[model samples]
Target: MPTTTRSESTQAALLEAARDVFAEKGYVNAKIADITGRAGRSIGSFYNYYDTKQQLLRALLERFPAQIVERARDGLSDDWAANIEAAVRAYFHTFRDYLPEMIGVFQLSMSDPDAAAWWRSQRAYGIASVLALIDAVEQDGDRIGLDHHVFASAIVSMLESYCWTWLAAGGDDVDAVFDEETAIHTLAAMWRRAMVGES
Candidate 1:
């Protein structure tokens, strides 16, 4: 592998530090000082990479979908059940891996219009993927029996909310923390059932 340059290394450090800080303190409450401190770099160095915390957070968020796609690619299959399971598993792992970005984007989106728009764009991407899957299923003579657009939207919403609730928000019941495989299987089964009526 090609070696990373000094600038690239510095930026990587900053991003990693930002992720940790965001996870611990959240986007709104996290400070530049904290990130810099965690990164073991001066505050000035952070600006050399990103203009603001929002920019850093955006960078992280941009990686989320691509990571999921990459992980899910190998698991994708012609079977609808396998496809849903693969997608759900990929999303669950990616969400866990990028929990900090998930938390940051969600918190920032609540107050910033640009952030909110970005969040919606992310959801739109998922919705489009779902619609494509729906089309494929229909072409295979499998009737969905629901409005394609609405079904796509609802599926995306369900995946997003469920991941956020369990992973980021810790769910409602403190005693109910789920194992990774169980969570992924549960989501995959639910999604598969929604699409084809049997998990």
Candidate 2:
């Protein structure tokens, strides 16, 4: 049990280090040696843990979405639209919580095919949730709205755009820009416009 705990701890550290290096240098330019150096381990030691850099990179790309979903689940369990809004907010807030890691992920997504795939999956999940929200809004079947999928796509695009801007802002304190209140305001505004056709 103790050995497993130690392995888990070290794996987390290595994952963090890989994220940093991958972000700064990208997959093509990032070296296994650099990752190992950042993790304070030798090449052989890194091999002992991960089979390859691509696998590690895949793991790094996947870590945050799962975390965001978990946090959303914890914080959002009420109404569906409200939960979606809360989930979006929670994701951005969590992104800010790990800004440096996020920057790396963004950078990787730009140049690495694997990273791009991971990013696409992330966006797809958000878009799917927004579509679900649209369904809930139309549960009455009045068709009393614009095409929910269209609106959902637009909203998801808007959100990802904002997040990309935040990631690139390079401010000393990025998290301050995305507090709970900011999320509530932006998400609520968009959702209200979509569901009620006010905007």
Candidate 3:
């Protein structure tokens, strides 16, 4: 294995420190001083890796798609239901695992055009995956009587919003608590039903 350089180590420390600070203080409120202080690095070291906190947050956000893809790769099959279930579970867990990045992107996207565009691009990535799934299903001689693009967009939106509502924003109903398995199954069932009219 290649040894990690001091520069790489410092960059990793800064990224971890930023995640912690963003989690505790919210992205908008977190300061470069806080991140550097937590990382035991100088402010100048931070500038060497990232020019702004937004750039650091973007670096964190970049990991999200890869994590989702890796997690969703397991248990994939010709069966659409199984694929949908795996994808839903992967998304839910990844959202929870990377809550800081999700929170940072959502908060910054409101005022930052670049962040907003990044957020949209992330959603588009999900949409594209769904569209590919649709293509595979159609190639298997199944007909979905809807516009493919709209259907894929709706599926991605549902997954994104539901994950945000439950995992990030807390559940919508205070009295209704859902376990992880239940939530994943419900979302997967909805997606599978919408696609092929059976769960």
Candidate 4:
């Protein structure tokens, strides 16, 4: 029992260390020794849990909260605008919290076809969420002319790209402070306008 507990603790430490190192040095640049040093564990110990840095990154991706954006819900109200805001807020919050892992996964996607597919899968979750909301709106007699799948894909791309640009790489204007509420509200308003033709 004690041995199992120790193993779990070591794994947990390695994960935490990887998160920090990946955030600081980035996934592409981070080394196994750096992760082990941060965890205060030997290099060999890292191998006990993960065979490579990519595997560690995959583990982190598995733990990311992708479901928040994937499973967005509509409130029991007629105001679709507010519902959009709520959904955008949910996605923004999730991305803000896991910016590092998002960056890592995105970086991996560039070099690895499997990671690219996984990235698309994550986007698919966002696409599905948007589709659900759009379907609800369409059922209420609104005529949606655009392609739902393409539109949803664009929205997800916009959110992910903008968040990565601002949250992860810092906003273009270094002097400007990051405002969470304003960012969410702005994206939601734009999305609402594009989706329902209302501001």
Candidate 5:
């Protein structure tokens, strides 16, 4: 039915709009009416799809990484730096794409249970990717107990934080150049430091 198809489309739009809203506003204080407004849908129609903001947010949270994972896999290869670069590009692109709507997900996660769970899930996936890169880069009989994962996490953490700051800063193309230079130099340093033997 056309009505059913339209209903599905409206629900998809709201879910996407809610993802942006939650990412920007965070989960604790974001309102359903605000999400509905962003989706250009009636309040009642919004309810027809999701009973609450958290429900829609969870759906979005799930969908977001699924999309990213598909992208990550598409760009995946045995080459670690390429994979890493592709992954980072995918992440930032997603972040940039969702920048306007993610306000809710950002502002209110510290206290919300659903958000906490979703974040744990997201963080775990990130940690896995970091570990994969570490495994790729580390040679056998390398330094043991170096806490490479922690090291990798700290590196990616800085990258993610910097990305958010860059997006928030509203800067020019010069800022992008700075980011590119800094990331390449910093990551090269990380690789150098991570080396345990001539390889």
Candidate 6:
């Protein structure tokens, strides 16, 4: 029992350390030695839990929040405007909470096929939630003239690109300041207006 407890504790330390290292150095540039050093564990200990850094990334992705899936599965609220705000808040919150993982996926996906697939799956979850929202709006008797899938695609892109632009890249202009409330309100307003014709 003591051995198992130590193993679990070591694994948890490794995972947390990996997140910090990946956030600081990015996945493409991070080395196994860096992760092990951050964890204060021997290099061999890493191998016991994960064969490669890619496998560690897979583990992070596995634990990625399933909010989108849960939202889609649970159905949306009857209050369309409130729902818009709620969805936008949830999206931004997720991005903030998992900024490092998101950055790792974005940076590595460019060069790694597996990473690319993982990134796509993340987008797929957002798309699924957007589709469900659109369906709910339609069922509420609003006519969404645009192709629903395309609209959902656009909405997801807007949310994702905005988050990446401000959160990850720190926005284009150095003088511009970004905050959580403004970001959430802007995206939520856009989503609400786009779906219901007024913010």
Candidate with top TM-score is 3
Candidate 4 residue lDDT tens string, 32-129: 99999999999999999898888888787774445474534533357776778878777777777777788898889999998898778767777887
Q: Quote the positional error of residue 99 for candidate 3 in Å.
A: 0.5
Higher-scoring candidate on TM-score, 4 or 6: 6
- Per-model clash counts, in order, read 0, 0, 0, 0, 19, 0
lDDT tens digits by residue: candidate 6, 1-199: 3456888889998889989998899888899999899999999999999988888887876745585445423444768777777778777777777888778888888888987887777787778778887887888888888788888889998988988898888787777677789878888888878876874
**lDDT over C-alpha atoms for residue 135 of model 4:** 93
TM-score ranking from best candidate downward: 3, 1, 6, 4, 2, 5
Model 6 alpha-carbon miss at residue 38, Å: 1.5
- Expressed as tens digits, the lDDT of each residue in 60-148 for candidate 1 is 88878877778878798778778878888887888888888898888888899998998888877778878888888889989998898
Global fold similarity of model 1 (TM-score): 0.92
Window of ten residues with lowest summed lDDT in model 4: 67-76
Alpha carbon lDDT at 36, candidate 5? 85
- Which parts of model 2 are misplaced by more than 4 Å? 1-9, 19-30, 51-54, 77-81, 140-144, 171-180
Q: Local error of candidate 5 at 149, Å?
A: 4.0
Ranking of predictions according to lDDT: 3, 1, 4, 6, 2, 5
Model 5 bad stretches (over 4 Å): 1-4, 16-30, 38-40, 139-145, 169-199
Task: State TM-scores per candidate.
Answer: 0.92, 0.72, 0.96, 0.86, 0.69, 0.88
lDDT winner between candidates 3 and 4? 3
What TM-score does candidate 6 reach?
A: 0.88
True-structure lDDT of candidate 3: 0.88
- The residue-by-residue lDDT of candidate 5 on 87-161, one tens digit each, is 766666666666643444554465677776766667666677667666766653345356866866675576556
Stretches > 4 Å off in candidate 1:
174-177
How close is each model in CA RMSD to the real structure? 1.8, 4.2, 1.2, 3.0, 4.6, 2.9
**Candidate 6 lDDT:** 0.81
